[model samples]
Target: MRILICHNRYRQRGGENLIVDSEKAMLSERGVEVIEYVRDNNEIDGYGLVKKAMLYFTTTWSKEAEREIRELCRKYKPDVAHFHNTLPLISPSAYYACKEERVTIVQTLHNYRFLCPGALLLREGGICEECIEGDFRPALRHRCYRASYIQTRAVVRMLKKHRQMGTYEKMIDLYIALTEFVRTKFIEGGIPPEKIVVKPNFLRNPPDPKYGGDYAVYVGRLSPEKGVDVLLNAWKKIKRFQLKVVGDGPQRAQLESMRVENVEFVGAVPQEDVYSFILGARFVLFPSVWYETFGTVMIEAFACGKPVVASNLGSMAEIVKDKETGFLFTAGDPDDLAARVKLLIDDPTLAIELGRNARAEFDAKYTAEKSYERLMGIYASVIREKETV
Candidate 1:
């Protein structure tokens, strides 16, 4: 199959970027022909004030992206055009380009951007779904995006425009939601249920499971949404379990300043190193306050025979069966988080059982072989449906 994958790269490498790269590689390794039309956010870094001001319009629809994509579609004549991130660079115009060429368009709903201006369903360090179901006023009122009214307004306008244009409804052939929780949210947010498919992220290449460790580990960005502060507070209450944080973000300075005891902040780490950290831990923690779509790291832990202690919210709650594969704590509750960790710490046998279960779960649901099957199945369905059209 000849596939055209387009993505607007983030300034800093984020999970979506990593997933896109992994997916492309996976397809290539399977002997599929993949063509890329990508743009980078770094292109805006050197732009002057006036040029930057023009970005407001492009975020909604980019004529340049449309032209470029149209040219590529004509040249490549790809069977399917799959898109990942298109935020400020590639824009929604890529959809129009694909539509013009009769190329099937499949988009992964990476976040809540289609339903919320903030893209995270997060505002002021908490969950906020004010813009879901086609109402963006609350987002504008709260200036929920990047804490800037202008930026929020810009995103809100893009959302409102494409929403009205039937871009979500008519242009795209399929929408790939990372989890069932995410798929349900999109359905609730007015996306058609039949068009949305649930496909969780998988480990492209995984390391062997390593068990038996005294320290607990956290693998994710140290940001407010990640609930790093909650983890720290929980750690303060119970210094019995040594904590190692593996990732960095804007909140690093604030978290480092807290002087939380028995914790080592390893800063940002590479993918392989993250697996090693998880392998060496007693259990992994994901204390996210917001409804995480699906955490890639959680699966990584499962693949490494490590039990995860995740927030009892969204995909985490569903993915990590409480006391089965991993434990789930009350979201943002430090005391509850501490208690869950204590449960595992007090009973190493239970932790080992959960770790074994988690590894089994990874093999059954998240291995590269299973992922490729589901991915190809989704693509085949889209292609078959497209042929009928």
Candidate 2:
């Protein structure tokens, strides 16, 4: 099958970018023809004042992107058009181009942008779904996006425009949600349930399971939303259990300041080194405060035969089965997180069992082979439905 993958690259590369690249490579490895048409958010930096002002309206419907995609479709005539991110770059207009060409459209819901202006159901270091539940005016009032009223207004306008245009309802065929929890939120936000499918991100090349090792691990951006503060506070309360935090972000200075006896900040490491850390760790920490659409790091830890202690809300609850594969503590609660850490440290046998189960879970549900099979099934279904229509 020939596929045309579309994406708008974020300023800082993230899980979504990795997934897109991995999926394309997977398809190619399986002997399927794949082509990518990508745009970068960095382009916005060079725009004039007038163009910057126009970005708010164009964010949801880019005529330039639509025309460009239409031209690509005319030349490539791909069997399916799979999209990752189309935020302030490609825009929702690309979907209309696919519709106009009668092509199968498959969109991956990498984040909650469609439902929340901030794209993370977060405000003031906690989970906030005010925009998803009701009026987005709260987001406007709080200046959620970049903490700028103008930026927030732009995001709100984009969301409102696409919503009114029926872009999501009419243009897209299939929506690939990374987790059941995320899928439910999309449904609650008015997306058709039948059209949404759960497909978790898979590792391109997973690390070998580490049977036993020392130190606890934390991987991902060291930002407040990631619950680094909670993790640090919990570590301070605990007497034992060495915690090694990987990855660098805005919260580095703050994290460095609160370094306890057993807590160590290793800063940003390469992706391979991250997997190595996971393989060497007894457990991985995912104490995120905000609503994570999906926690890719948890799965990575699982792939390395490491159990996780994640937040007890959002996708983390769905991913980590408490006392089974891993444990879940109340989000942003330092005492609860510390208690859970103590539980894991106190029971070595239980921790080993949970780690074993986690690796098994990864083999069963999150392997590259499984992901490819599921993706192919979705692609076939979308194509058949489009043909029938």
- By TM-score, who's the top model here? 1
Cα-based lDDT for every prediction: 0.90, 0.89
Give the Å error, residue 209, model 1.
0.7
Give the lDDT of residue 25 in candidate 1: 94
Q: What is the number of residue pairs that collide in model 1?
A: 0
Off by over 4 Å in 1: none
Q: Which 10 residues in a row give candidate 1 its minimum summed lDDT?
A: 206-215
Assess every candidate by TM-score. 0.98, 0.97
Residues 213-300 of candidate 1: C-alpha lDDT, one tens digit per residue: 7889998887789999999999898986789999999999999999988999998877767777888898898999988888988998
